[model samples]
Target: MSVSAYKRVQRDLESPRSVERRIFNRITADLETWGAAYDRAESKADRLSALKGSLQLALVDNTRLWSLLRRDLSQPENALPPELRAAIISISYTVDRITADLMSGAGTVAALVGINRPFIDGLAGISGAEG
Candidate 1:
């Protein structure tokens, strides 16, 4: 391949959109795995164990992802509209609340599943990955 083509490929690989899509894909996979674990848990102890391990970790990772997105959106060069940034901030707040509730044993698997669906859908929409 030409040097210019190779350079273009390298740049595309490192672009912010590519990075964001990769992050989103990872988060989606984690959520799916956690969801399956939650589905298979047959007892409260089992469910709680899953929640404490994979589910909690997924939530933390997701929160961190959103935090990074919010930070990026706050930069002057970010082209996303102000309303989109505000929406991200609001979702971040919800994620924090959900994480706190889960940690405190005040959350259910159903609640967590409910919270995850919208995020998964949104990620799928943005990444066009059917996640």
Candidate 2:
């Protein structure tokens, strides 16, 4: 997200809001941050030996975020439809597997981004646009 956009979200968050909207904003912003970090890491890692520390940080953060999401989704009163929650849980597993692969240098950051892009769009109410 642009600085202006980030600022706007911050402003929006300062006021009263629904719990669902707050969660949505936080997740979307974090994804944007992770996406930018991954993009930067990919560019910096062209030499294979020059990987950025930001990549590791982003990966760890991504895992933590998914863990939180999974825990929340598992709750009986999460409010999301069952099918959508289940699908997200399934994708979280894929993210877990891919995160391990990427840690071992056998996966691309792009894969992680591809998985997240759709969720980001969906959270923003933009359906089915290519990541």
Q: Each model's C-alpha lDDT?
A: 0.68, 0.67
Best by TM-score: 2
Q: What tens digits encode model 1's per-residue C-alpha lDDT throughout 2-100? A: 999997888777856556666766775776778566557676566667776777788788778877876887788878788988887787777778767
Number of the predicted model whose lDDT against the real structure is largest: 1
Q: Lowest lDDT 10-mer window, candidate 2?
A: 43-52
Clashing pairs in 1: none
How much is the lDDT of residue 119 in candidate 2? 66
Local error of candidate 2 at residue 104 (angstroms): 0.7
**Deviation from native of the Cα of residue 100 in model 1, angstroms:** 1.9
lDDT string for model 2 (1-131, tens) is 99999988977776432433455455445545544545445443551332346556667767877788899899999998999999999998999998786665555667776776666566556778553
